[model samples]
Target: MATGDTMQLVHQALRENSLFARLDAADLERVVQMASVRELAEGEALFHEGDLVEHTHVVADGLLRVYQVGPKGSRQLVLHMAGPPESIGEIAVLSERQHYPVTAEAALPSRVVRVPREGILQLMEERPRFTRALLRSVAERQFELLLLLRRVAFFEVQSRLAQYLLEQHATLGPGFPLPTNPELAALLGTVPEIVSRTLSRFYKQGWIRLEDRRVWLENEVTLIAVAKG
Candidate 1:
């Protein structure tokens, strides 16, 4: 895209995004001046956990997956999936953390606006509405992390998988595009073999139908009951 066209898209995204919706014209223009666009191909790592935090990124398009790798390097736990207009690395910037808490990767081809940490800090200091919005966004992300942690601690893998399937069904509809076994396992905090076994069990139980790797919900009530357990 042309530089002018990209800037126009960025301006529109800032206006529409919850984090930047409160920025006035002057502040938005300042941000536009200070930001640079970054493009990522699928499977590209944006930043790894423990890397020094230097910039905050706002997704312009496509998907970014935030995750943490296990100590033994045998497992990956997905923390979140961020889409257009969503901010990444903001918590590190807000807290002035020296290093990133998790790794971010492009789940698909993506574009993100990279704003220098210093510039973002300056804006936060100057814009009260922006500061408030940033705080709220951070708090909500923390809450979601806490909830996921709780489930991982207390829920069985089967129950968690069921819950995840139900969630995907609700969000993406009956003919939901399914993640690969390994990806699904990462999201559910397990290994692929286990995910495959459990999914087969679900299939036999008539909880879901899988065709061409896409899942169709067969019975939501049973899945909900399992999810609650």
Candidate 2:
């Protein structure tokens, strides 16, 4: 059961979300009523990689870190941050195999609004707009995956690192914590030594300013150029 405040938060997050924002008022209300809030402590997993899909989630507060762990126990970070109004496992509602390919864990104390798979599929069948929204989500994810593959195949470490920095700066501002290098390395598909060397090179090139656990952009122009390559 959801508390009044938690319910309110879910309603607002769904309204703001890309997939749900297009829903009509009554349809939105119905979906909200079917939703329940889940609270998670730091490091708690909402689901492990390969878990059978039962529900999708909207982050009502804090960050959800989506990743996969290799057989050798190495983490491959898929998404470092999924915060308010962002969703996970939405496409799984349409998946035939119906297993979440990545694990979603709370990077900090977090709140999630759980939407059951059967209910969302039912809504999709009855609502044309909802179905279209789901299709668009699927298309967007595919496009992003293609881009990721292209980058991994063709882009150099410095280019990818520059792109990553620019993306993080866009999402999290320039001075956010540099707290997790190993996870960052996994996200970049490289080792920490290379990431460190790339950052050192950027520092020498006067493209970035680095402090204890934070970085500030000194030259967006150079970073943008490198990212484009």
Which run of 10 residues does model 1 get worst, by summed lDDT?
12-21
What tens-digit string does per-residue lDDT give for candidate 1 at 94-153?
775699999999989998888889988887888888899999999999998998898899
For all candidates, the clash counts are 0, 0
The residue-by-residue lDDT of candidate 2 on 1-229, one tens digit each, is 4477777898899998888899989988888988988889998999988899989798988888887777788647464468888888876778797798888998889989899898889888898888898888778877877777778789998998899888878978978667466667877777788888888999998999898878899999999999989
Q: After superposition, how far is residue 127 of candidate 2 from its true place, in Å?
A: 0.3
RMSD values for the candidates in order, in angstroms, are 1.4, 2.2
Off by over 4 Å in 1: none
Local error of candidate 2 at 46, Å? 0.8
Clashing pairs in 2: none
The residue ranges of model 2 lying beyond 4 angstroms of the native Cα positions read 77-80, 170-179
